[model samples]
Target: MSDPNPSPEAFRQMASEYIEVANRQGQDAYVGAVATAMLHAGARYAAFVAASNSPNKTQMQLSRKTNLDQITAQFRTYLEGHYDEHSENYDSYIKR
Candidate 1:
């Protein structure tokens, strides 16, 4: 089965939800899941933008390895920034 294609906002919400879960549960597994969700959302959005920019009307490859790698890196950096913010407010989340 194919994964549901989720919007950027969907991913953001997922990340937030998972982070809260992680804090509440105090589980490393939930932390990983949250990060994965954030990265996937970022990558999906990047791929959508890349495909929209293509001029070809015919069937074309939507993703190349290098391009995806670059996109993932950018997304990782963006996710890390959010993670930092979450970490800062982690105590509040845990208290919930």
Candidate 2:
């Protein structure tokens, strides 16, 4: 079984792996497209997890909005933090 809660280092490592894969897609893949794919994959996986953890279809249906809200809120927070961090180096990043 996977750890219920991974350490911060482990979380960063996982994120790095995803970034590596996105980078490996080469110049042909637009950054926006890659980001969209990642977002879709995250939402798909979250839905699967929610369904798996629910006792039944009715429970899953009942909790769908709450689950979605929680996931999106977490994503918003993380995105905002990272956006701020990157904004500090926007010029250098844009030049790359």
Candidate 3:
């Protein structure tokens, strides 16, 4: 017996599904990746917003931490490794 969702890819798929919905009126892929992590995998409520004319992510939820700490650690690793929007893996996951 095993936990099916113990892997990051599994979490990614689940979170990506939620993100497809999130993207209906949502953020672009980079921040969307972060948002998906925050919302689904991290299992925490998240809000994504940009500062006035700031192209960079200058205002993110830095202080808060997910109660699901293990999932959050894995999700953060997944995020750093796959930050590029054009990555085929990410695109596939995002569309799925």
| TM-score pick, better of 2 and 3 | 2
Alpha-carbon lDDT of model 2: 0.90
- True-vs-predicted CA distance for residue 49, candidate 2, Å: 1.1
Estimated TM-score for each candidate = 0.43, 0.90, 0.34
Assess candidate 1 and give its TM-score to the true structure: 0.43
Mind giving the per-residue lDDT tens digits that candidate 1 earns over 37-58? 7557666887787777656634
Report lDDT (CA) for all predictions: 0.69, 0.90, 0.54
Q: Give the Cα error of residue 89 in candidate 1, in Å.
A: 2.3
Better of 1 and 2 by lDDT: 2
Clashing pairs in 1: none
User: What would the per-residue lDDT of candidate 2 be over residues 27-87, giving only the tens digit for each residue?
Assistant: 6788889888888898899899999989999999999899989988999999999999889
Error of 3 at 84 (Å): 4.3
Q: 93, model 3: CA deviation in Å? A: 13
Per-residue lDDT for 91 in model 1?
93
Off by over 4 Å in 2: none
- Which regions of candidate 1 fall more than 4 Å away from where they truly are? 1-44, 57-63
Worst 10 residues of 1 by lDDT: 54-63
The sequence of per-residue lDDT tens digits that candidate 3 reaches over residues 17-43 is 865865664554576566656466335
